[model samples]
Target: MEKKTNAEVQVNMHEEMRRAFSLLSGKWKLEIMWLLNQRLYRFGELRKEIPGITQHMLTAQLRELEADGLVLRTVFAEVPPRVEYEITQKARGLGPTMEALTAWWSEYGQSVPEKPSMRGRKAKAASSKLG
Candidate 1:
């Protein structure tokens, strides 16, 4: 049996952690990655799923992930044309890590109160006063 030397193990561990952080350390990368994990989505579909993400930001983020070799972008030729994005094998490998994070979120998400939405509150108040 062969064993990894201490230095080799440390280097491997450091690289793995660095890769994880590089892929996930961003405002929308994790969110986008998780969504992509579910299934490939067209540009518009992704935009709809991630509310509050402007088109410009989403496009920029997707381009960055594509450049990092974590995402696959496919374009189809048609009358209107079609484009889709999906996680590459490298990104899909993060499935377990993402799933664990998702599990943690499910367990604690409900206990956390989301920020108040002024637009939502105002609409509710207006409707109540009208009725």
Candidate 2:
């Protein structure tokens, strides 16, 4: 096997991280996935559940998520067509990550007094660092 340089290994790691994050990159992608993880939501229901998300933005985000295979969009045949959204198995795979974030936030984030303070952030990061 060929020996890879440190820079090459770092680049590979960054690429992997980028590709992984890209699937969930967006203001509402994670939130949408988290909500859908619980139950199927019709389009309007989703819009109402998430505050400040416009209809156009929700549609666009849902389309992007569906394209990424993280969300499933189902349309029912009826007098009035109904569309529902839910998280896919691929997205359910992220449940552990979501839970980890929730746990971490519940423990550390709530303690932060206010926003725009790096003192608390740096202290927390240093304390949380593990070898």
Best by TM-score: 2
- Tell me the tens digit of each residue's lDDT in model 2 across 77-118: 986999988898998899899889889989999787876633
Q: Candidate 2: global Cα-lDDT?
A: 0.84
Question: Which pairs of residues have clashing backbones in candidate 2?
Answer: none
User: Residue 101's C-alpha lDDT in candidate 1?
Assistant: 85
Candidate 1: list runs displaced more than 4 Å.
1-16, 116-131
Poorest 10 consecutive residues by lDDT, candidate 2: 117-126
Error of 2 at 27 (Å): 1.6
lDDT of 1 by residue, 36-128 (tens): 998999999998887677788889899999999889999999869999999999988889988998899899999988986432112223444
Note the Cα lDDT for every prediction shown. Answer: 0.84, 0.84
TM-scores of the models, in the given order? 0.73, 0.75
